[model samples]
Target: MSNTSEAIDNDTVIKEFIDLFAQQDATTLAPYLDQDIVFENYGSPVVKGRENVVSLWAEVFSTMERVEFTTLNQAVNGDIVIAEQIHGLALPGRPFAPIKNMAVYRMRDGRIVEWRDYTNSEYARTLM
Candidate 1:
């Protein structure tokens, strides 16, 4: 059992956090992450800490013209939520493209403590 004062709905929190990413609202996204969050995106180095993750997202948002994630499928098991998604991005001169990917999140007290993303590095590279 969790020692936290309130029980957290893992599914709801995961969905809301992803929705914030789809909206490119890093400011709103920050609160949903644990202070010592750990994130690993495919083809990228592992990022640790909530503030560092936010900074990374800030850099991404600044570089891209638009970005969004369309959830294709999702499942929740205990404190883990797995989501299959289509990542859409519109760069400065490129047309919007869809990148198939999946994200696994581990939640604690309604905040994400660990997040790991899986996707094709070749496809992701093309976006750059």
Candidate 2:
């Protein structure tokens, strides 16, 4: 636990983290990450460390003209949170259909310690 005084419910932390992603602002997202955070995308290598994770988001954001995530459902169990969402993305010249995404988050001291995203590779490939 980094700061007990600032600790919030793990569910809230995960919800807010997902909300912040819609804004596509990595700087705003940084405070919600633990220093040693780990982020794993569906088909990519694991990203370790807060800075590395944030940088990855920044890169993704830069390539998108618009990004939105609509939560279909969310569930919480202790410090673990699971969110099911439809991710809407728009690139410069292509319209990205909403893609189903499932993310699991682990919280510690109001910050995200780990995040793993699962997506349909076949559906995702069609968007490219």
Candidate 3:
């Protein structure tokens, strides 16, 4: 495959990955992740492996009434995709609010191998 095609494919995969999160379908997300995918979230221990990440998200989905992300800005460079987003969550008996955050995703072979998230932990604490 040409380099241009590979880059396009990588971007598509990353977009699909983000869509999966918006859909809150952890099961469907598994196929888009590398077997040894590493995921890091602000104020949380680094989660290793695709299966483990799926399990963790499943648990979170079970607890939250709803979770959604709106991409404010996104860019792709080589194998990396960076996004600034508004993440919103609705909890039982609590008003939903959007939190600003950023995520960097590294794609390999059309699958995300590494995902790192950045946000204001102190502000997030107040929201939770």
Q: What lDDT does the true structure give each of the candidates?
A: 0.82, 0.83, 0.85
Off by over 4 Å in 2: 1-8
Better-scoring candidate (lDDT), 1 or 3: 3
Which of the two candidates, 1 or 2, achieves a greater lDDT against the reference?
2
TM-score each candidate.
0.88, 0.88, 0.91
Q: List the residue pairs that clash in candidate 3.
A: none
Q: Which residue ranges in model 1 land beyond 4 Å of their true spot? A: 1-8
Find the candidate with the highest TM-score and give its number.
3
User: Residue 25 of model 3: what lDDT?
Assistant: 69
Steric clashes per prediction: 0, 0, 0
Model 2 scores worst on lDDT over the 10 consecutive residues at 1-10
Which candidate would rank higher by lDDT, 2 or 3? Answer: 3
Count clashing residue pairs in model 3.
0
For model 2, how does the per-residue alpha-carbon lDDT over 1-128 read when each residue is reduced to its tens digit?
Answer: 53332334776676777788679888888999999999988789999999999999899899988788888888777677789998888887888668899988888877889999899878876985
Angstrom error at residue 48, model 3: 0.5
| Residue-level lDDT tens digits of model 3 in 1-128 | 57677677877787677677667768988998899999999799999999999999998787778788778888887788898988887777788868889999998888899999999988876886
